[model samples]
Target: MALFRTSIRVFHSSTRKMTTSSVTRAPFLLSPNQVSELTNSGHTHSVSLLDSTWFMPNSPRNAKDEFLSKRIRGAQFLDLDEVASSHELGLKHMMPDSQTFARACEKLGISPSTHVIIYDSHGVFSSPRALFMFRSFGHENSSIIDGGLPRWVDEGHPLDTAAPILPEPGTYGLPNLKEGAIKNYDDIVANSQHDPATNGHVELVLDARPKGRYTGTDPEPRPGLSSGHIPHSYSLTFNLFLQKHKTKTGQEYSTFLPPSEIKAALDNAVGTAEANQIINGQRPVVTSCGSGMTAGVLWLGLQLLGVKQVGLYDESWTGYSMRPTSQIQKTS
Candidate 1:
């Protein structure tokens, strides 16, 4: 009897350790199939599915209207612009204050323990921004659906066109922002002119805009904003982390590249040595783009690569460019 009891105790201890390990290794990206399984399993009461689609000013499509027309069943619309705080420099989707974010999450039925799964109409585009927002507000139990709505549609998963029924408001508190998760204009300026001897560690600022915009060879989509990259920043267009796929019916969608492919893309973008520095933790990375939306793509990509010391510049280029004294760099 004593020997049998000892074996049972060992088995229970091993099971507990395995369970803890599984929880810690939870993925930040969930596939369309995975999401479907969870929904089908009747576990959605503890999960919040959010459609986080957004478009640039030049785009004609409206995100909310499309969400109303079609979305994952039981999903709610999370308006990026509506939940954000206003920026003095006319930037869109700036990170909201703690109270505002808490209220937004509570209204969305997203308590701290709720597992948020976000998706966007344009595959992985704006969903990362939504995920980043959740993480910034200390909601670490969040993930983005890989390939988003397009992939879900491609997989022949059913979408609901009916109006969504809102869940009861959840109880959430004003969580503090994660340290080093956000970077401001002044931080950028200091980093741009960083002296390793004084600054302690070198930080890499990566621009997620297209090569032409980074080199000042193409006009910015936003009117009156100058086309130029930030000083000491490297251009690694957000699209590099994604790959296009075609459905059986000839519809096309984008999905994130595998980790190996992503590493190769980083090497190609910043050269092998610099990319290695980033991967090996020799430098921290801060991602930026037009209005900080696409920057989240790069941020997510790095997270996928297991790089932890990453930050997002919430104001990004829009606010940076609008400042009278901001430095601008052009390669073309």
Candidate 2:
């Protein structure tokens, strides 16, 4: 009953100004309240709220195990590591080709028409990657649930402990494979700014790894990999942008800080003048991370700021450092 009332309220408030593009593009960061209202308002048929939760291999908490224990009502579990076709390629969570991705989408009950809303068990982690992946495949109706599972629970939304109910498999075909959505090794090598002093490049590489890993002062989390970063890549630890906020119910959750603050931090990492010019997609931005996981976080951050040309290094450092011809640079 309460949800019904909430849905009615949302309808009343949003109906007046709702347009085709508004629904089509839908806000990238969805609030828990808005999600609940949509679910209860008979608006869930076309929506797919996925639990895109993934944990590091060594982490004690298992994403699938936890999703099985409890998750948002009408949500599906999408294991980032397992959903793609990267297993045969030896790359961790790298995207598969369009046909494979389309098949995986069918299995998940997602079509090109489905509106994808992703969240993660961790406050703000793997969901961005899933959302980006969807966009890469021409799904424009994709968005991320802000603050993710923690915020959803903190807001007192309903959860189902039972197994997720799967819809009949849906058919998906890539209509608009957004080129330059992902930057592969060859793309990186071609675009890399080897000598920053002499080369005047507009596109900049943003590495989302921690400072220690970025500088090679700390060993990589994955063994058998060198500890360094791509040449001329700027390091902006993904977690550094997450700000703590309290819910109405007094529970704390993580969210990206305000745009101004985020812009400041980004400017500090990249040159202030350069950062200013990167706005509204004017300059292309390439993001990377340890294993292409946290890179999505940074990618999403740039999108939130309305930077148009953001691209993810699909395999990130894991693939780069393994290449015999790749150049690894260390600050120290």
Candidate 3:
């Protein structure tokens, strides 16, 4: 049996309204201006601003060092690697157990009622993963800053270099894991065997890695891992969901493409018919990437397109490829 049942809805972004401390904003996303306004109004106590920056292992940038040097005023750093579960497979950013997650939240001064606004140093890169973590832990009162810290700086928002003050530990309790929010390796294997043409409820696995990696023409960044895709999975690079835009000061940054453009990209990736099936909830979606970080981008993109029946393969390709019995498809 699949870990996630067909009836489970992963995230309901539409029709869900969330209030950010003193300001009521749309659920799941907030603009930089709105975040600044909330902080300026002295409602920071009711909300937690988390800088959830991360980079690939090959990247020279250290997210924590960058955050320490300069970060949004009143923002606390949430290390994705540190706050995650110590996976037996050595997967990075695996969702921690409920007790562990609750403790991390408490240390960050996050109560059950506190609204979390997550952002990354890179615009819209890893913040969605952070948002997913919170939501998976049943913290639905969280949202991501629309364009992250780069956009904030592009808009002339000031950064604070001062050391962050430790937050008083909040009285947080163990949270229930959201049922069906994650898909495991067995689930993927089962999903792969289901023929979507015959099974309308079949879950679609969308790969968020680059096409080169998906086709097995390029080497995986991680050593010893085979480069290929999950059977029947569609390659939809995470960057397709984002677009580059120049700010007023001539600084260019990346942000989510508009809904129309995102939908078009989806159509291109999975074909119009399959995309429609996903959007209309006839076929559920489980997004996967090399290590599951970029997969959150696809998860968020589907939410933006109003696809409610979606989940993330938490261990993603990393876990899948490591399984000796796993089947990998390569086009090239």
Top TM-score: which candidate number?
1
TM-score of each: 0.90, 0.89, 0.90
Per-residue alpha-carbon lDDT of candidate 1 for residues 1-332, written as tens digits (9 for 90 to 100) = 01011112111111222122323123578788877876777666777899999999999999999999999988999999989898887677899889989999899998876778899988889999999998777676678888899889888899999888998999998899889999999999989987433453768888999999999999999999998988888899999999988777776667888888899999987778777878888878899999999999999888878788789999998889989999999995
Give per-residue lDDT, candidate 1, residue 254: 77
lDDT of 3 at 91: 89
| Clashes by residue pair, model 3 | none
The predicted structure with the larger lDDT, 2 or 3, is 3
Give the distance in Å from residue 73's predicted Cα in candidate 3 to where it truly belongs. Answer: 0.7
lDDT of 2 by residue, 139-225 (tens): 767778889998998878889998778878989875555888878888888777454435556458899998999999998878888
Candidate 2 runs further than 4 Å off? 1-23, 87-89, 196-198, 245-253
Worst 10 residues of 1 by lDDT: 1-10
Candidate 1: lDDT over CA atoms? 0.83
